[model samples]
Target: MKHPMPALLILLGLAIAPVAAQQVYSWTDANGTKHFSDMPPPPNTASAQRLNVRSGVTTTQAVEEPAAEGEPAAGSGPAMAAAAGYSDADIKRNCAAAQKNLERYEAAKPAEDEEAEVQTRYQEGLSKVQSQIKLFCG
Candidate 1:
C-alpha cells in the first residue's frame, strides 16, 4: 500500500496558504487609540504599520497626519466601510440601529438612587453609538 504522508503534507500546505497570505495592520488613530485589524487604517492615518502574520514582524509605512477636526480622513467614509468588508446594506442596517440607540439614550431617565452611575453608563453607550453612526452613515 502507498504511504499517505506526502499527500497529507500537501493538503496541510494548502490549508495554511490562505492564512499566510492574510495581512494585519497596526496604527494609532487621532485619539491615540492603537488598533490592529486585517483592514488598513485610512490613508491619512499616521504611523501605520503592516504586520506579518506568521513571523510577527512589522514594517512601517509612510503616512500623512490624521485629518483635521470634524473632517473625515482620506479613504474613510463609505469606501472604508467597503474595504472593511461591510456591504452597503449592512452599513445601512447598522446605521439605523445606531440611530435608534442614540434616540433611546437621549430619551432615557435614570432612577434617582443610581442616577450618577446610570448617567455615566448612558454617556459611554451614547459615545459608542455615535461613533458607530459616524462610521456607518458617513
Candidate 2:
C-alpha cells in the first residue's frame, strides 16, 4: 500500500510540525545590514540591538543557542518531551522510536489514491497514530 504524493507530504508535514522556543536577535552591523543569531553577538563595533525571544514558535528552523544550556521551549513536541526526566541517551532512543512509528504509519498507505474509502482509512489511521504519539510522548 502506498499513499498519494499529497497525502504523504501531509503526513510528513504533520510529523515534523511543532517547534520550540525561538529567539530572534536582530542587530544592524557596522555596514547597517541586519543580522540574527541564537545568541548575542560577541563584542563588536557594529550597532547591536536585542529582540525578545518569543515562546511557542512553530515553523522557523531552531538554531541551538550557543552554550546557553537552554531547555526545550514550551511546546517543542518530541524534543520537549524527551527533555523531561530523560538523559540525552534516553531522549535519542525515544525520539528515534517515535519517528520510526510515524514512518511505519506512512508506509501503510493505500495503493489506489483515487479510492475514497482507502484514502480515508489511511488518512484517519495516520492522523490517529500521530495524535496518539504526540499525546503520549509529548
Candidate 3:
C-alpha cells in the first residue's frame, strides 16, 4: 500500500511540474514609480499585481498614453511598423484593392460552396487593408 501511494504522488507531482515554473507582474503608481514582482514582496512595493494571465508579466513600462493615438504600438516589432506604415493615399488604394479581392472571392463561389474558404481569403485581404489604414492614419 505504501509503495503504490508514493508512486501516485510522484505521478501527480510530474503532472503539475510545468505550470509551477512561471510567474509575472507589472504595476505603476501616481508618483511614476513602477513595480514588478512574482508575488507581493513587502509593504514598500509599488503595488499588488494584476490577476489577469495575459498582463501578468511586467515586461515594459506602463506609460499613461498607449503608443500615441494612431501610432504603431510599442513592441509591435520593426517589421510590423515597416509593413503597416503607409501614406493616406496608399491606405485608400489598398482598401480599394481589398474590396475588389472580396468581390472576386464572392463571385468565384466554388462548386463545393465552400463559403468558409472564401471568407478566410477575403478576411486576410481585408486585414492587409486595415493594417495600412492603421499606420497611415497615424
Candidate 4:
C-alpha cells in the first residue's frame, strides 16, 4: 500500500515551478549601453549577467570604491577593512564565532593529516579567526 499525499504534493510543486522560473539577462551592446532582456544573449558576445525574476529577488551589483592616492592596487593590498560599527548583540556573536573557529583550528592539528592543502587551509582559517577576534572583540 502506497500513500498518495506525497505524490500529490510533488505534482502540485511541479505545476507551480514555471511561475518562479523566469530568467532575466543583462548585457552591454556594441555602443557600451547596458540592456536587460528576457532572452539569453547571442553567442560570441561578452558575458551577460543573469538574474532569476522571483519575488523578493533583487538584481543589483556592488559598486567598487576608487583607490585613494596612497592606496596600493586592489589585489596587492590587505583584504581587511577598518572595523565597522556593530550592535552589542552583533559584536558578541562575532566574537563568539571567531573564538569557536580559532579553538577548532587549534584543536585539529593539520600536521596529523598528510595533505598539504588541508594544512594550508587550517593555517588560513586560523589566521582569519585571529584577525576577526582582533577586529571585533577588541
Candidate 5:
C-alpha cells in the first residue's frame, strides 16, 4: 500500500497556510487619515481594526482616549459608526454617495436671480454631506 504520511503532511500544510498569512492592521489617525500596516498601532490607539488577510475577517477594538478640549471623545463620534451596526460595505457606499453629493454641489452654478438662495441651500447641503463623508469614510 502507498504511504499516507506525505498526503497527511500536505493536508496539514494546507491547513496551516492560512494561519501563516500576515495580518493587516488599520486605523485612522487624529488627522482623519486611514493607515494600514503589518504592525499594530501604538498603545492607546483608538478604533484600531485587525484584518485577517487570508480569512477576510476584521475585528475592531476601540481604546478610548481623552477628548481634547472642545472636541468629542475618541470613538464617540463618526469613528463609532461601524460599531453602531453598520458594515464596512455600508460605510463605503454611504461615503461614496456623500462624496458625489459634495461634487455635485461644488459644480452647480446658480442663475443670477436666485444666486443668494441657491448659495445658501448649497452651503447647507455641503455641510451635511461633508459631515456624512467624515462619518462614513473615516
Candidate 6:
C-alpha cells in the first residue's frame, strides 16, 4: 500500500490544531503595569485587551486611562523611557534578554499539582522583566 504515514500525520495535525491555537490576553495590574498571557485576567476582565498574533496588533476593550506616575503623559505605554545608569548598548541587550525571558515564562508548562505556584512564578518573573524593559529599553 502507499505510505500511510503521510495520511496519519495529516490526521494527527488536524486533531491537534484546535488545541495548538490559543488566544492571548493583556491587562494592567494594580501597579499599572501591562502584562500578556494565554489566559484571561481574573478581575476587570471586561476591560482586558486581546492581542492578534497573526497581525501583531492589539485591541483594547476599555477606554484609555491616565498615565501612571513617572510615565510620560502624551504617549508612552510600555516602552522604556530611559536607561538610567546603563549605557545604550547595555540597555538594548538587557531589553532583548528580558523580552526573551518573558516569552519563556509565558510558554512554560505548569506541573499537574503545582499549577498555582507555576502561575505565580510566571507572573512574578513577567513583572520583573517587564519593568526592566520599561525602565531601560525605551
| Per-residue lDDT of model 6, residues 1-138, tens digit only | 599999999999997776555577788887777888988798755558766555356556467687788665444423334323555567668778877877887678466678787778867877888877666554
**How many pairs in model 3 have backbone atoms within 3 A of each other, for residues 3 or more apart or on separate chains, i.e. clashes?**
0
Which portions of model 1 miss their true places by more than 4 Å? Answer: 1-74, 109-114
**TM-score on alpha carbons, each prediction:** 0.43, 0.33, 0.37, 0.37, 0.41, 0.36
Model 3, range 1-138, lDDT digits (tens) per residue? 757988999999997765554555566666766766566545655565744344254345456555766665655433244565755566556556656655675576455656788767766766765555444333
The best candidate by lDDT is 1
Instruction: Give the true-structure RMSD of model 3.
Output: 9.2
Candidate 4 residue lDDT tens string, 25-133 = 8888888878888788876668688878777767576767777776533432132222344655676678788888888878886666568888788778888888888
Tell me how candidate 4 scores on lDDT: 0.72
Candidate maximizing TM-score: 1
Whole-model lDDT, candidate 6?
0.68
Which residue pairs collide, candidate 6?
A: 80-134, 80-138
Higher-scoring candidate on TM-score, 2 or 4: 4
Of candidates 6 and 2, the better by TM-score = 6
- Each candidate: RMSD to true structure? 13.6, 19.5, 9.2, 14.6, 13.7, 16.1
| Alpha-carbon local distance difference test for all models | 0.80, 0.64, 0.58, 0.72, 0.77, 0.68
> Which ten residues in a row are the worst by lDDT in model 3?
50-59
- Show model 6 residue runs off by greater than 4 Å: 1-83, 109-113
lDDT of 1 by residue, 5-78 (tens): 99999999999888867778889988888898998789987789887766566546468688888655666665
- Model 2: lDDT equals 0.64
The deviation in Å at residue 76 for candidate 6 is: 6.3
Quote model 1's TM-score: 0.43
How many residue pairs clash in model 1? 0
Off by over 4 Å in 3: 2-5, 8-19, 25-83, 113-138
